[model samples]
Target: MYALVDCNNFYASCERLFRPDLQGRPIVVLSNNDGCVVARSAEAKRLGIKMAVPLFQVQEQIDRENIAVFSSNYALYGDISARVMTVLEQQAPAIEVYSIDEAFLDLNGLETNFPLVEYGLQLKQRVYQYTGIHVSVGIAPTKTLAKLANHAAKQYPATRGVVDLSDPLRQRRLLGLLPVQEVWGVGRRLSRRLNQQGVSSALALADCDAAWIRSHYSVTLERTVRELNGQPCMALEECPPPRQQILCSRSFARRITEYRDMRSAIAQYCSRAAEKLRQQGGLARVVTVFIRTNPHSQLETFYSHSASRMLSIPSADSRLLSATAHALLQSIWKPGFRYMKAGIMLSDLYPSGSFQPTLFDAPESPAAMRLMQAVDNINRSGRGQVRFASEMLSSGWQMQRNRLSPAYTTRWDQLPVVRA
Candidate 1:
C-alpha cells in the first residue's frame, strides 16, 4: 500500500500558522517581486481570485474584500515544510518527499487488518499538531490511486481530509466521477485528446486496453492506464536524481539601466546557483548569464541575450562561478535597454571529484573549497549572513516584497512573542 500526504494551501497556511487572528480570512501569497498570485486560501478561492492572476488585476477586488496579501516568505515556508516532514518521518516506516508540500509513504508490511483510514487520520492530526499545517491523506494499493484519493480528500469536505481507495468498487466509483485529467499522469492536453477518443474520465481510461493505449499513445501513458487499474507501475523514489543544471533567475522589482547594477545582480544569482551546485555535490563546467528587457513593456525596446563560457576545469566554487558569470554578463550586456530580469545557469554538471583534470587545468584549491563550505554553513544558519563582496549589500535591483511577513521560524528577531 502507499499513502500520499499533501499540505492544504501550503503557502497561505504557513502564513496563517502564526497569524491566528487571520484564520478564515481571504489570503493570497504572491510570486517573486509581488508579481502574481501563487497560492490562495479557500476564502480567497471563494472570492474568485484565480491562481497566477496579476496582483494589479485583482487589486480593487482585494481591497474591497479585505483580502490579506503576502509576498512569498520562502524562509518561513521552507522551515515549516521541514517541520512537517519531520513529523511524517517519525510516523512512516519509509517516505519519499514528492515536493515541498507533499510526500508519499510506504505502507506495506502493516498488519492486514490494520485500519488504514484511521492511521491516515492520525497521521494528518499529528502533522497538524506538530506543524500547525493541515494535510490531506490518501491511501491505496497504487501510487496513482493514492494521488487520486488525496485529491478526493481535498475536494470533498465530508471525507475530513482522509480518503482510502483500498476497495476496488470505491476506486471505480470515484474514478467515474473524476475527469480524465484528474488521473495521476494525464495532463490537460492529453486529457483533451483522450476526451476526443471517448476516454473522458479516470474510469474510462482505466477501462482502456493497455496494449492499445501503448500502441496508440506512449508506454508512459500505458503505465498510467495500468496504475489506474490498481496495478503499481511507479515505485517510490526515496532518493531523487541530481539535477543536470542549476538556474537562478528572477525579475527585478524595477528596471535596471546601469552596468554596475546588472553586474551585482548576476553575481548574486551566480552565488546562489553555486550554492545549489555544492549542495548537490556537483561541479559545473559551463557558466551562462542572460539579461532581458520586459517583453510586456511597450515603452522599452525589447532586448535579450545570453552568453556561456566553458571552464578549464569543472568547479563549484562561488568566486570562480561568480567571476565566470560576470564575464558572460559583460559579453551580453547592452547599454540602452532597461533590463527587467537577469539570471545565471550552471550546466554540464558532474559529481564532485568525479571529473579527470589535466595537468594544464587548474582545479579548485582546497583553501577555496574550505572558504566556500564556511560561507555556505553561515548562510544555511541564516541566508545572506555571509555573501561575496561582488554581491550588492543593498541595491535597487532587489525584489520588491513590500508585504512580506516576518521570518517567524528562521530569524530570532522576527520570532513571534507571546504577551501572556
Candidate 2:
C-alpha cells in the first residue's frame, strides 16, 4: 500500500502553530511581496476568498469580514515540515518527502498486522504532538488513488483526516464521482480535451485505451491511467536529485525607477541563486535577468523585459555569476519605466565538479573552495548573511512588505518560551 500524508492548509496551519489564539479564525497567507493569496485557511475558504486573488482586490473583503492575513513565513514552515517529516520517518519504514507539506509513506507489509486507518490516525496524532500541525493521511494501492483519497480526507470531516481507497470497488466509485481534472497530472488543457472526448470523470479517463491515450493525449495520461488502475509506475524516491534550474524572483512591494536600485536587486537575486546552485553541487551556464512593471497599475506605459547572458564558463561561484548577471541587467533594464518585479534564473546546469575545464576560464581553486566553506558555515551559524556587495543592503534588496510571524521552530531566539 502507498500512503500520502499532506499537511492541512500548510501555511495557515504554520501560522496557527505558534499563535493558537487564531484557531478557527479566517486567515490567509500572501505570496512573495504580499501580492496575492497563496494559501487560505478553511474559514477563509468558507468566505469564498479564491486562491491567487490579488491582495488589493480582496482588501475590501478582508476589512469588511475581519480576515486575518499573514506574510509567507517560509522559515517557520520549513522547520515545521522538517519536524513532521522526521516524526513520519520514524513511524514509516520509508518516507518520501514529496513537497513542503506532503510526503508518501510505503505501507506495503502492514495490512495483516496493523490496520492502515489506525496507523494513519497515529501518524496524525504524532505529527500534531511534534509540531502542532494537523495532517491528513490517505492510503491506496496506487499513488494516484492515494492522492485522491488525500483530497477526500481533507474535505470530509467524518474521515477524521484519514481515508483509505485500497478496495477496488471503492476506488472505481470514487473516481467516477471525481471530476477528470481532479485526477493527478490532469491540467486544465487535458481536462478540457478529456471533456471534449466525453470523458468527464476520472473513471472514464482510466477506461480510455492506453494506445489512444499515448497517441492523442500524452504518455503522462497513460501513466495516470495505469496508476488509477493500481499500477504504481512511479516508485517512491527517498532523496530526489537537486533541481536543474534555480530561480529567485519577486514583484517589488513598490515600483523601482532608478537604475542603481534595479541593479542592486538583480545582484541580490543572482547571489541568492548562485548560493543555491553551489549548495546543490550544480553550475549554471546561462544567467537570465528580468524586470517588469505591474500589469494592474493604471499607468499606461507598461513594459517588461528579460535578457539572458551566456556564461564564459559554467560556474556555481557567486562572484563570477553575479557579475555576469549585472551585465545582463544593464542590457535588459530600460530607464523611466517603474518596474515592479525583477529576478534571476540560473540554467543549463551541470554537476560542479564534473564541469569540463576550459582553457580560457579555469575552475575554482582549493583556496576558493575553503573560502566558500567558511562563508556557508558562518551564514549557517547566523553570524552574518551571505553577502558580497554592500549595495545589497543599501538598495533595500530584500524580501518586501514582510509582516512575518516568529520562526518558532527554526530560530533559537524565536522559539516559544515555556513558563517554569
Compared with the true structure, the alpha-carbon lDDT of candidate 1 equals 0.92
The whole-model lDDT of each prediction reads 0.92, 0.86
Per-residue lDDT over 363-387 for candidate 2, one digit per residue giving the tens place of the 0 to 100 score: 7776766777677777777445668
lDDT of 2: 0.86
lDDT for each residue of candidate 1 in 86-113, tens digit (9 for 90 to 100): 9998987889999999999999966375
For model 2, state the Cα shift of residue 407 in Å. Answer: 2.5
| Candidate No. with top TM-score | 1
Task: Kindly report which residue pairs in candidate 1 clash with one another.
Answer: none
Global fold similarity of model 1 (TM-score):
0.97
Scanning candidate 2 in windows of ten residues, the lowest lDDT window is: 390-399
Residue pairs in candidate 2 whose N, alpha carbon or C atoms collide under 3 angstroms: none
Model 1: how far is 143 from its true place, Å? Answer: 1.4
